[model samples]
Target: MRTSGVLPDAFTCSFLLKACVSLLDIANGKILHGVVEKLGFGSNLFLQNMILNLYGLCGEMADAMLLFDKMPQRDVVTWNTVITQMLKRGDIEGASRLFSRLEEESGLRPNQVTVVSVLAACADLCALDLGKRVHEYSNRSGFKNNVLVCNTLIDMYAKCGSLEEASRVFDEMEGKRTVFSWSAMIVGLAAHGRAQEALSLFSSMLQDGTEPNGVTFVGLLHACAHMGLVDEGRAFFTSMTRDYGITPGIEHYGCMVDLLSRAGLVKEAYEFIMEMPIKPNGIIWGALLGGCRLHKDIKLAEQAIQHLSVLDPLNDGYYIVLSNIYAEAGRWEDVTRVRKLMKARGVKKTSGWSKITLDDGIVHEFVAGDESHPQAEGIFRKWDELVVEMMLRGYVANTSLVLLDIEEEQKVKFIYRHSEKLAVSFGLLNTPAGTTIRIIKNLRVCEDCHSALKLIAAISGREIVVRDRNRFHCFKDGCCSCGDYW
Candidate 1:
């Protein structure tokens, strides 16, 4: 049209922008944006929003924010577009700050979309206090009864270590429950090690005439894995095809391998992987390797690592695990070789860290042996006190898997200063005696830390909830909710 000297109108630009968004053609979209400006169509709000949508969908947040700041007039769609894109790029904190700006600056009440997205961010960060504030706002704005918002509320509460609140939300959505609602609740319960409750709820879901989907079964399999119910896991896996006609996806298959592996069925899990109709992925082999680690089957671990090196060569955890397995068997030569290979491939092991959210809604993070916080002095002092009490209560440090050639005393000190312990120590020092301490860890909790936390919870007269990479461990009265399975 430009070459023919026939000027394109706003509607033509709008349709072409929509096509660009659909095709994800950002280069053409940029040229069209310049053409729109050159044609004096840039001031059109509809056209501007379309261009913003184009930038956001194509993962060009820099351009989106630039345009967003320049627009003199905006709408809720503009804010939601930017917020959603921020989340897609894994900027949970940024999305949250934008939501706050939306409220403080725009004078625009958040709609259901904004509420749901913000609630998801709250869940990811385990920001329970902020989530509660949002829940209160949702109630005042009459969004509490919206099914999607309610579903997200359930998920947020569960992930934030408030199962009672999650259950309350689930019950409140009684007549309005959908498959997603049921699945979210079941998955939440399973994650918290409430396997019996999850299974019972599934039966009730069936009685209520809700058909189970793949997600629902995934929850069931996870519940079984936590409880070490291998037979029940097999039954559920078979029923997915026989009764529900739901073909298993990679997630379902992964859950099955995890279930069998955690139950000490490493050999059976390996056979199951080989017989799979679909090709096994890294998660499948990783599950088998984790099982081998648990059961101390070095031969099977070596076999699994061969496949893992080809499938997921850059995952530092696999190499680290293989090294640890060799260390366990007193094979220092092989451990050194694995370490050399990791160095050669530029694979660095991920350092473990733990974070806790306080009542003030700020997250405090601690790394292993971290003493950088202002309260570092008090935190270590608190740990010293807990150590005395824990040793008196029969808490022996299990340093069998330290994997270091250092002195035994050094190894003991190393495990004692694990990140989760420091985070929990901080929580105990700050909170009252009876308050529950919730912690989130970046990696799986070590055996020594897990045992120590159990005793510490009993001695401190508090409930300690630790969300690790694999699952949650609720410690109270010298016992764990996982029953020592996970």
Candidate 2:
């Protein structure tokens, strides 16, 4: 048609752009962008939105935003397209800000798609306040009964450290609940270490005539692993194949290894891996190594490391865990050797960071010894005050995991500055006395921080909820939800 000098109309360009989006053909999309502009169809809202969709779907957010900014008008689809893309790329805060703009400035109420996307961002950031506002909006808009929105609400509430709310949402869904509703609640309960409750829910799910799927088993296996119910976990694993007719995937296998490993069946877990039909991945070996670390199985840890070094060479956490294990065993020479190996391989430890969402619906982040926040001085001062109370409450910092050859006091100081500690102190200073403090961490919370938080919660008379790399730890009255098993 171009060779015959037949000019493409807005509909023709829209059809071609839709095809580009379907095929993820960004190259052709760019060429068509020029064609649309050259053909004087640039002002056509339908064709322009299609081009934006092509850019967003193809991972060209820069171009999408460029086109979006230049558009004089945008409908709900336009905002949803950009916001969903932001989510796919893990830009939770960006998506949240865009949702804010949509609410405050766009003069348009968000549609169902926009609400789901914003709820996802809220869940990821643990922005409970913003999530609650969105939930209210859903109710006002009559979207509360919508299954997809309700499912997302369950997930959001659970991750935000409000299991009570999550359960309420699940119960309300009742006849409307899908398999995902059950699975999401199960997984959330498992992550919170309410394994028995999670399993009981699965029983109810089965009784309700909901057929279990692979995801359901993953949640069940996770529950069993966390509860240290080896026999029960094994039964569930076998039942997946025998009863449910579901072929266990890598995640299932990983959960099994975690269960055996956590149960101190290191050798059995190893043998289990050797006998697997599919090849084990780094997560499989990493689970074994974590068990070794817990049980101090040095020999097995070394073997796991051998496979880990090849499978995930650049992963610094593995090297660090190995070194810590060596340090725990008082094998200074082995620790030194591991450090040397890491240096030789140019692997650096991943920096741990923590983020906390305040009532204002903004997420604030911190690193170990972070002084970047505007209230850094107040945060540090509050921590100093908490240290006095914590010490009075018998909070002696456990420096056993601190590998550095330093004085005991120096080790304690090092422990004091971990990212979670900073985030908790910030929460204490910023929130009211009785408000619960919620924190999300990028790495496992160190033992020292865990112990300190228990005492902090006791002394502050506040509940502190922490979600780390593995699971949730809710501290209240000088006790953690995991019973220190994690």
Candidate 3:
């Protein structure tokens, strides 16, 4: 068309914009944006929406916002496009602000798509109050029965830790719930530790003629794993392929590995990985390594490390886990060799960190040597007191897991510097009395930290729930919900 001395029209530009989005060619999209401007079609509603969507897809939030702001007329699709883009970029505040301004400033009423997008943003940010407000608006606008809206509401409520509200939304939907709807509810239940409810809901979903999908099975399996229902997990794993015709994917395999590993079936879990039709990825092997750590199976842990190292050569977590395994098994030589190999390969250990949401809804994060908080000194002092109490309760400092050749006293100090401890101390200092402290760790919680949390929960009389990469550990009343298995 350029050779013919004619520029592409709006429709042609829209098609090219989609191609650029699919290919993630932001530069080409910019070139098309110029073409659209030069052709005097920038104001065309459809073309503008397409450009907005393309920028959003490419994660160019700034450009998408500029386009959205310049649009002469805004519709529901335009609003949804921009809001979804903001949510995708993790700009929850900006998305919420825009959502609030849409009706009053732009006279644009949010439709189901807009509501779903906003609800998803709420879910990602765990904005419970905003999610509840959106739910009320959805009801007032008579979109309560819209399946997509209701499903998103369920997901939002679940993610915001409002499982009851999620269930209410699930029950109130008028039509037969779809697989996604059921899956959302199941995921909610699983996340909230309502394992039996999740299983019952899965059975009900099956009975309602909604065939279970991979996600549904994953949720069900996770529920079973959390509840220690090993036989039920096995049956579900078998029924997934045999009865439902759903080939087990890597996620399914990972869930199965978690189930078997958590059930003290370390050897069986290792064999299951070998029997997988697809090559086991880092997640599956990592699950097995975790199991080995739990069961103290040094041999299987070593085998898992070998496979995982080859599968993810650049991943530092594998080395960390393997070194910890050797340390746990008192194989000092192997630990030393692993350390040397890591040093030779220039692989540094990734620092573990955890986050806790305070009463004001602000998430405070901490890592080793985190001195950024205003109350760091006080928090550390409190941590020292808790460590003393823990020691008196027969808590031995486990220096082996640090994978370092430091002195025992230094190892104890290092344990105090762990991210979870820092986060827990921060929670103690900042939160009111008896407030439950929920911490999320990026990696597995080390044995030292886990024991410390148990002590903290007991001494402080605070419920401490730590969600690590693998599973949830609820520490309360001097014990962990995981039975020290994790």
Candidate 4:
């Protein structure tokens, strides 16, 4: 059109920019941005908002900010564009700073879109104070009755570790709670170990005529798994389709595998996987493999390895899990062979790590070979102290769970390298005396690490909550809240 001497208007330019965003053509998007500037439509609020949106969609925060800064007269949409963009890019700090600046300098009041975006940032950062402030802002701005804003507030509070506040927001919602609202509460309750409440809320969701979607079922399944309600889990698994006409997806199947496996029904879990309507994915096989490790079912563990290797040939966790299974079975030769295969395939196991929030509200993370922190030496020394204290509290590290072909001493070294232990040790050093340590891991917490954590919790007189890939384990006084079933 430009070449034909028919210059595009602001609306035309905005449409083209949206098209570029949809196609994810950042190069073409920049070209369009230049065209908008040349056409003198760059200052148009609508066109500028489109540019902001395009930059955000492309994850080009710097470009978006530059555009935002150049805009002379900004509207709520303009601020929402930049704030939402920052949130999506995981720049919570940038989003918060901009929000503060908008209120202080721009004098532009935030709308529902702005509130949603800011709430999302708060949730991602786990910034409880910021979230509460947003909550107050929403209330003062009369957005407290907005269902979308209320739902987001519920989610923000829940994710930030304030279930009571989440419940309060949930209860005060005058509007009909949507499925998402129910999901947020269910997830929050399940995550915080309020499994029964989660399940009850799920039932209430259905009774209130809100049809439970796949996510709702997933949350219910998770609650059932946490409570060891295998019968309820299985019933829900079937009811998902039979009663609700919702087909069971990979997530549903994954939850079922977790539920059965955690109940020590390893063989049944394996059989269920074989019978899945869809071919079992890596997550399903991984769950069964995890169950095999927990129950020490070497024969089934070997069977699980065959499925896992074929399903996820490139994932190193399968190889590591299989090797461990062989080690647990006392098959050193098999372990050696598995190691050789891993070497030949160039499969490197993923390093495990954990994160903990200190008393000062700073999150410290640790992984194997982590040396970037300023107090690395002090952290290691604290680790040593915890090791001694743990042993004094009758904590015997379960080296047998290492599933290595190495001697006992080597196995002990491997256990110490676990991500949970590193995070716990760091927590001990950074937190105040008697402060509970909450660590979240991306993988399953090894049995040895679990036992050691219990001992550490007792010796230090601090509660410890560890959220692994599968479930939550709350440790206090040398015992886990899960009753060792997980």
> Which prediction has more favorable TM-score, 1 or 3?
1
Question: 183-231 in candidate 3: lDDT tens per residue?
Answer: 9989777765678889988878877888889999888988877767889
Write the residue-wise lDDT of candidate 4 on 181-255 in tens digits: 999889877766667899889878878888888888888888888778998888888898999999888999999
**Number of colliding residue pairs in each model:** 0, 0, 0, 0
186 Cα displacement, candidate 3 (Å): 2.7
Worst ten in a row by lDDT for model 3: 355-364
Question: lDDT (CA) for every model shown?
Answer: 0.89, 0.90, 0.82, 0.80
lDDT of 1 by residue, 1-486 (tens): 679988899989988998999899999999999988898976788899999989988999999999999998888888878887776665656666787788799898888887887778778877777678778889999997899999999999988889899999999998999999999999999998899999999999999999999999999999998888899899999999999999999999999999998889999999999999999999999998999988889988989999999999999999988898888889999999999999999899899999997776567899999989999999999999999998888888887868888999998888888999999999999997799999989999998998999998899899999989888899999999888888
Query: What digit string (tens of lDDT, one per residue) describes model 2 on residues 282-385?
Result: 99999999999999999999999999999999899999989989999999999999999999999998999998877665678899878788998988898999
| Model 1 clash number | 0
Question: What ranking of all candidate models by TM-score puts the best one first?
Answer: 2, 1, 3, 4
Best TM-score among the predictions, by candidate number: 2
Q: TM-scores for all candidates?
A: 0.89, 0.90, 0.85, 0.83
- Candidate RMSDs in order: 3.2, 3.0, 3.5, 3.6
